[model samples]
Target: MAKPTPLNLLADLAQNDTEAATRELGRLQGLRTQAEQQLAALNKYREEYRARMQAMAQDGMTATRWQDYAQFLTSLDGAIRQQGQALAQAEAALLTGRANWQSQKRRQNSFDTLVARAEAREQAAGARREQRANDEYAARLARAASHRQD
Candidate 1:
């Protein structure tokens, strides 16, 4: 059984951090998508309402009916504006999340590189040790053969 390398342990922790960052980025992206969908729906409803108002105008609406339509359209416009703001905020959050994920990924890669280097060093050291052991064994066998000949 080989002892665990410190570099390997650090690499594991870095990988965990990367995974958490990825999850957070995914959540932010979901929120951004939902905000975009809501904004689209609001715009679509506003367009449909405008079309209805136009049709009513052709049919000769009374002054009161026109006033009511204007008021409702104003309210829709306000709602649409609010939704746009919300969408912007969500997009900003998504951008921040992406940046964080990238940073974590870079950290993980660095740790992985360190681990690879450590493993290579360990392997080289093991090889040297094995070679030395074989050389000593051969030397002992040569000495024993000389004594037997004597």
Candidate 2:
């Protein structure tokens, strides 16, 4: 069996876990902010395209106008498709980041639990050692008192 780490060693692990959790949480937050920004930008582009298409329709012109509208519609379709792909990619990245954060949290919790258990065991051992020392001192005092009387 692997030897258990000494109680003194647990402090380092606890500190490391705390630091890791903080870092992972920060990373997750950053990824979420980036994803939201990308989605917002995509929506803005789609809205701008809608406005332009409406303005073009109001003119009501000739064949050349129809061709221009067709070209505009095709470009709009491409932008919408690209936006959808980007949104999907952003969502996937967010989900992966969330999972990574959750995994880190679980590791931190495990380390915390281990450190607490180790500390409790160390405290109990210290108490036992103290009690034994006290008992030995009392026995010695009793023996000295008896010798003095004799």
Candidate 3:
């Protein structure tokens, strides 16, 4: 049995790191989607509120009612902005995770290439040793036949 190379161990570690990075990227994407959904819902609700306010104005709303509606709309806008920021952050994190995964994959591939080269070298060496033994055996057989004839 051939002894294991350090490259094999390094490759295993790199594979684990790559898998972890992939999971992290997936989680970030999920968070970004949730943030987007919240932003969409907030905008939809704000539009509905504006429609209701318009209907109220047609019926003649009080000044105090107008002030309250304006304040609530402002708060909704602020929430929407905050959600947008969160989504941006999540997207950035996802990009970073993807980069890390790619780096890990590259490292793993390098180690794997090294391992393959080492195995090929070992196989070649074994083949040479086998050929040498066959040649030595043939030489011995020829000498034995020459001695028998003499």
Candidate 4:
């Protein structure tokens, strides 16, 4: 855990934002996958139905039966079109989610960089203070030794 400095607080917030974005991206990916699977199944079923209708027609169906098959095929085509639109929307959402995640990640990285630089600066300042104390101690020892000799 980092100390509760302003920089650390900002970094924590950035981390949280990034995590949320990642979760959203995952959800969007799942939706896109589902859409793709559904579309594929619908296409496969439509083709199978068409094949069956062709076979039945070759065997000479009644006019009424023919109309039923043609009407059903039209409905299936509409379903396919609707499914295609859903898939396209899912893809668009996924694309936008990815961009959001990337932006969040970049923001998190920037906060991390700022925190690192601040820590380095603090450490350098501490080192300077220690060096100054050591120099002062040495000078005191030298003066004491000369006083004793006198």
Candidate No. with top TM-score:
4
TM-score of each: 0.93, 0.72, 0.86, 0.95
Candidate 1 lDDT tens digits, 50-141: 99999999999999999999999999999999999999999999999999999999999999888787778889999999999999999999
Compared with the true structure, model 4 gives a TM-score of: 0.95
Candidate-wise lDDT, in order: 0.93, 0.71, 0.87, 0.94
Among the numbered candidates, top lDDT falls to 4
lDDT of 2 by residue, 1-150 (tens): 223666435545655766776676677667667766766776687678667767877876577877786787687678667766766776676677667667666766776677777778778998999999999999999999999999
How much lDDT does candidate 4 score? 0.94
What would the per-residue lDDT of candidate 3 be over residues 56-142, giving only the tens digit for each residue?
A: 989999999999999999998899899889888888888888888888889878877888888899999999999999999999999
By lDDT: ranked, best first: 4, 1, 3, 2
- Span of ten consecutive residues with least summed lDDT in model 2: 1-10
Instruction: Name the lDDT value of residue 9 in candidate 1.
Output: 82
Q: Model 1 segments beyond 4 Å from truth?
A: none
Write one digit per residue (lDDT tens) for candidate 4, span 108-127: 99999999988898889989
Write the number of the candidate with greater lDDT, choosing between 1 and 3. 1
Q: What residue pairs clash in candidate 4, if any at all?
A: none
- Which residue pairs of candidate 2 clash? none
